[model samples]
Target: MSGEFHLSVVIPNRNRAHSLARAVLSVRDDDAGAEIIVVDDCSDEDLSAEYSQLQAMGVRVLQQDSRRRGGAARNRGVREAGGTHVSFLDSDDVWLPGRHDRIRRFYAAPGRDRTVLVSGALLHIDGDIRRPHQPDWRPGRSLVEYCYRDGGRVQTSMLSLPAGIARAHPFDEDLRVNQDTDLAMRMDRAGIAFHIDPEPGVTKEESPRPDRLTTGAETADLSFAWYRRESGDWSPAARSGYFLQDRVWRLADSGRRPAAFAALARSLVPPVSPRETARRALSMIAGEGLYSRLRAGWRQRAPAPADPGLIAAGERWRDLDARARAFCATARDAAAGQPGTIQ
Candidate 1:
């Protein structure tokens, strides 16, 4: 078993015990040979039973004293992992059956770049799976280039970078939101190529309840400090973030718009390098157009009746369902000619 373990699945989980159980169960059911590590980030709820269950299935549980953010937790797990390749799974997301097997196969494929990170599909699911307004990825393109050309939304859950790359470019713990995007972009900058499988490899859970959206935004805003720190570098990821910040401003209400605008204004400042400045400008423009279209399409989709289970879940765990719903509603109204009212 030790000799055969070629991949390590690192899952950083906080207080979401139930969701964590489901995610780990998905891996256990797949019977994948990868070593599983669940890093507990000072969760208030005791997850001893879940730990025992995972251990029974050959998972290693690492407990951390401080509640470092998820990126930091993932970094800690990678340090403790023992595999040739490393894959990340968010606590709320699930790997479809055979995801690990498929990823390993991609790695083993002839003519594939061993140094290149491989990723595939990520279908967003709330109560039920719904198609994203925009394609998560394009077919047969360099994942790194795709991220560079567009804004980085590469699903880290479906990504498997070589052990060396993961060691060299761990997730930026300083970022609370958009950290995955930042990490992916950094990997690309570090010269890691990427291959994306055309099939769905993971499920990203989306919740559309009101309070949930605000919380998501708040948590997302926490990463702005990190963004400010990296503002000197106008990488594709940073440009993507700039467009994202502008959209955030567009969605901002009367009071928040000032702050949002201030952030966007800051992004206009050029990075020191000429190449970086040009890349940043291109990324901002590209991300803006893409973000606009996607938001428009989301508004076009018919809103389903609010799911009570989702709302209840939002209530219990400060889920993003409400916020997602609100965003959808605004999009819908905007699609129908009523300008979206920012919250």
Candidate 2:
């Protein structure tokens, strides 16, 4: 912590000219001596014209030989980077002001020991997260079955790792979706330590953007090498069920009600009666508002991590005053008027 601390900010982008400009500007505005690396993932047309201003500001831009996607682009950036620590920022998201300075102070904090990757809170721009929920979960030394838990995301934009750790476990370029989760799982398997601070690190512009990589369903076109991995106390089927439930919600939320029901029927997770599934499907297709409420009612079950360290790590977020309370209240309101089996 005493020596000069430098961070390499790697942004993997394609066809997000306007968002890319904003992302780059956000980093430049930090002025914390961060090295910015922009990896152009071979957009259909070159973006040199759109990004020349960034280049002029000492932002290093690298282009993939072809369309290898974000994971590959980020790997290239990490290889070319010179800082002791590296962070990934998607082209569309932005870092808030003072983020770089905070990272410096965080590393210098008392009891900050060992080489640990840091994961910060996400600011979702859309509906509340549901499914196997873990609202207050934070990373610990042991492997966490995160994919199943709701509110248990560690987004790529909110991650910063030692350059060595990042290099030792690079992103699997073949993945198009869930790459962030994949990396997190792999890191745990390799015994990498993580420090999660639930302070907003990235402001996500979440919308039903079919064009975005995260929402594009590109994984449908790719294979899952870690599809049913079992670590910690998670069973293979249990792990798969988490993603299975995810697909059901994805289909329902995307307005494919019938597909949602169909997928649910085929899932290994115990299925509700087709009549009940159809009822839910109709509600989803007919009423986005009701869909959210129904999901919110179900999400009242999100588990909070019982570990003291993990819980303490997120105290700053839980005690974020009115904003935090308001967010929690909103979630509660969504469950209003619903029959709570207290299940």
Best-matching candidate per lDDT: 2
All candidates: TM-score: 0.65, 0.70
lDDT score for residue 13 of model 1? 81
Which regions of candidate 2 fall more than 4 Å away from where they truly are?
109-116, 122-134, 138-144, 214-218, 221-233, 236-241, 253-256, 262-343
Q: 1-77, model 2: which lDDT tens digit per residue?
A: 66667899999888766667667766776664799999888777545455554555577888787899888999999
On the 0 to 100 scale, the lDDT of residue 192 in model 2 is 75
Predict model 1's lDDT versus the native.
Answer: 0.60
- Give Cα distance to truth, residue 98, candidate 1, Å: 2.6
What C-alpha lDDT do the candidate models reach, one value each? 0.60, 0.62
lDDT of 1 by residue, 309-336 (tens): 3343334232343433343344344445
Clashes of 1: 11
Clashes of each: 11, 2
- Output the TM-score of candidate 2: 0.70
